[model samples]
Target chain A: MRIARFDDDRMGVVASDDTVVDITDLLEQYDPLDAADLLPDLITHFDELKSELESRSASGGGKSLDDVDLHSPLARPTKIICMIGNYREGTDRPQQIMDIFFKSPEGISGDGDTVILPPHEASIFHHEAEIALVIGKESKDLSRDDAMDAIFGYTVFNDVSARGLGREGINSFLGKSFDTFAGFGPWISTPDEIGELYDQHITVHVDGELRQDYNTSDIERPIDELLAYISSITTLNPGDVICCGTNHQGLGAMQDGDVVVTSVSGIGSFTLNVRDSDARQWQRGVDEEMAARVRAQGQEAPAQGNGG
Target chain B: MRLVLTADDRIGVQTDNGFVDTSSVFDDIRFRTAKDRMPRVLAVFHERRSQLEELAQSGTAEPMPALQAPVPRPPKLIAAFGNYREGMDGDRQKQDLFLESPESVIGPGGTVVLPAHEATIFHHEAELALIVGKRAKDLPADESALDVLAGYSCGIDVSGRGMGRIGPSRIGKSFDTFTPLGPAIVTTDEIADPQKLQVTLTVNGEPRQNYSTDDMEYSVVEILSYVTGFMTLVPGDVLICGTNHQGLGAMQDGDQISMSIEGIGDLQVSVSDPHNRDWQRGIDEEMAARVRNRAGSR
Candidate 1:
């Protein structure tokens, strides 16, 4: 029951045999960018559509998965909320209230896409791998007991961050919202198939070297609690993603020409290439100003010890 | 030419005579076919600026109806934090920026419902809002940041001091109806100098905030240039150039707040208690249930 949007906005079902059964007809009325608006319809009619996809696959007119480009499973999410400092085991800092931040929808890049590093010389880009929850229905003030029901599926999210900018007071949103900073999904795995959401293992690798490996069980606030808190603040619409925070124990930076892979077991994985921005010369002054401000603020400079 | 979106989602253009339905005046086949797909208010303005301008001069005038947020549900709403020199938490050094929930936007004449949790010590921040016209990303040195703007409008950045003092400003500034925008979007061509406009806010007929945009630490171009340096800003995205700290104070329920920019028209809003509002009662009940359930489980 893996649903995906691939090459040229065609909707398809990934069969167990690693082939894609075209189900574009079922979603003819909606455009590729309107995938979020079509999510509830897909969920409500999942059974009928699943059977039809199976029949279509049986007729032997499917394509191999390798033949097409895979896009993000959920397109045009109204919001992408990321939990900050939700992991407690790795840090000795005092436990504070759970902080949530936002990343622009434009930052989202699909599987096999490239994440362009900010041209600023001041930026020290880092990768945070965590599990992401895709909303199935419009939700508000959801209770812990009902929070899990509101989730349609799970995907892996790479919360790419500019550590230098982020540490400079109240720039968390900007630091994590650069173009192509958010990389999620090969495809979405439904909640039922994920068995126990909190028990799954999450991992991140940079150029084949493991950078972070941890179990979701290590999360301080469970998935239900996070959902309840976020829902209480604002409405969560279909296709919206909630990225659970990552453990900072093995957190590090990414360099140009590096490939970062983030994976959640029993779900899926995706890789994104890192490239330097073309406007590096235009960014020099701003970067220098930011660095000078960081020095003026008199805060401890961000540790540059974790070079990849 | 000024454009507005009414309560019914109809588009209108304000001219010297009155407001006219844009569809009635601009009946081109291409425009009719592409209107819904554009997804952003700025897209329509960008594609058919000349046609719209010609129509604005000759279109039949009609009386205005209740207005909605000009660009309701913009893809992104980025606000400048402490960009003004007179503000209390002013960091005269560099511009601090933060993202606000687009859902917080409410049209002119809408009520700013004080969240039940922190009902006391609310503040009103009147500011100028820039509507981006094109897809701008990593703007080159030669391009002027102002060139990317489609128009300008007025917005109130309501803050709940209780919640805002705790940590990041997102939660405090993001309550529903916290952002009151509109009246009409004055085209960038209409304004002579956006940097020197007068910004003022009055609460219940008493003048509280009055300052010129000249007091801002960073000019509009500088702010937009810095923002585009990080993320892409598409048409219909909004940037609220921060508010002046002068005359900053608390607002209370039943206060009628009005924010006006020199060129753009005024945006009037009423503040109400959310605890007693019909829609908020449901949310409050759900929140109470969660609190009780959590306590019981513990």
Candidate 2:
């Protein structure tokens, strides 16, 4: 099922009208550990809470998502493993090189969020639309089959990168990790239902025009192998996220006031804003064509520019 | 409340055995004192018992401290690089001089402050900051050297920029409170594979940065081998593995940087302003006098 953790840090199923029940009570009642605990424990017990959420959705009635703020799906987890060049066109290197790239957890972000571009230095900050898997079990030295079992769900992630932070040239952690550089969520779909994990058509748009386009099958190692490769070395704890990699076309950038839209077929899409220091430092420059696309997709209205 | 940091070109530390005085760790070494005296800390591992157990048992040596740093500020920080085809595909070229200064580095229990400018670009990267456990000369085999690991600590390298190509990163990464470290160091015995732990970071209670040790292009063994080849890695020297791909994001004032490694523990720090500039004569005199007075007190 499509599951989501939203509204100032609480978990609940997203309904039709965008109205939300305070599932915080339900998640807490069913939670084996405090929401503050590590995410792996929560994922393991997620099924234990499943029936309870269904009951709450049926019995409780209060509050609306419109009235609350959203947070990244996983409250707190041990790690956010990411793919560097899994996308076909993400790098300047050859195909085999796609097998190696790294992003730390600090790169994650979520919906209605801002990608704070650094002002102290001159660098290109870009958004990458990628699929991220949230592991549900502690997995190590696992086979590809077991690795797939460890996956709890999938979510959308915007991996922001600060290019050339240093010329070390090898490690991208410094250049790619700036606070709020990574963005994910909107919702997470569970494993059984995450049929879109692979073979999903993906696309990224900045302001309005499409930027990145590809499918998950294009990833160098694919999800199962990537999971196996990682499990061989380090253990992946539940609630841990792995951004498989962004498609090739997602590279380059999002200017201030620009809205980035990344979508994966079957899963849905995420809309985020490219914000700068000065509110007006950027202009969406969207007037007609963008509005039509938003309507065609039946997505929510874009966040209005705050005149920064 | 223990803390370790790479400051003034070396690892600065706080320990149970008094301050490590990182500069002193190298005093007995044969290298030039100017270069050898980088402030830092080093822990002698138990595996090296054969080499050090005699000195330790005979009362000829003191118990190692929990944390340590270089006595002098590090000239630069580097990690394994992967820009080229050979580097990206694990060619083991040792060309990955891939290191950058933390936007700020502070001892554990110390606060690393960041400037608040919605206009300034910002981000934080969680990484493994190695505190050299011993002094090893000549490039030893990866297994022979890493086998002597004293312990490990957690740290973050914060960066701030308004543009895309910020270089030297030293100024942007070295603000007070920008790099927060300490809490505790997991002695090597407590850790099995240094390259196989969970590395993560959170800001204002949000999980922003995360990744595991195995993700690095160059394994810790490879990195240490390459690093030691350039010079003797003295005890208490810190090597910060550049952050993984969580991506650079943003932070305002009052943000907390909690960097953690699964078995190694975490260093949680709050952000604030450095307000650091030139020191005043009167203040300096008082501080100098305080040191002078304290010199006699001990």
Off by over 4 Å in 1: A30-61, A90-95, A277-308, B24-41, B87-92, B140-143, B162-167, B276-298
lDDT per residue as tens, model 2, B1-298: 1223333333323443433333333334332223333222233233333433232233322343333232222323443432112113423233334333321345554565554322244456677766666665444546666754456677666655331111222334534355555554455666778778888777766676566777666666666765554334545455666655333345545666667788777677666644332211111233223322331111
DockQ of each: 0.20, 0.03
Runs of candidate 2 with Cα error greater than 4 angstroms are A16-19, A27-41, A55-67, A89-100, A120-123, A278-308, B1-298
Q: After superposition, how far is residue A200 of candidate 2 from its true place, in Å?
A: 1.8
Model 2 has a DockQ score of 0.03
Candidate 1 docking quality: incorrect, acceptable, medium or high: incorrect
Angstrom error of the Cα, residue A15, model 2: value is 4.0
Tell me the tens digit of each residue's lDDT in model 2 across A117-161: 655343456667788888888676678777788888888777776
- The candidates score, on chain A by TM-score, as follows 0.82, 0.78
Q: Highest lDDT: which candidate?
A: 1
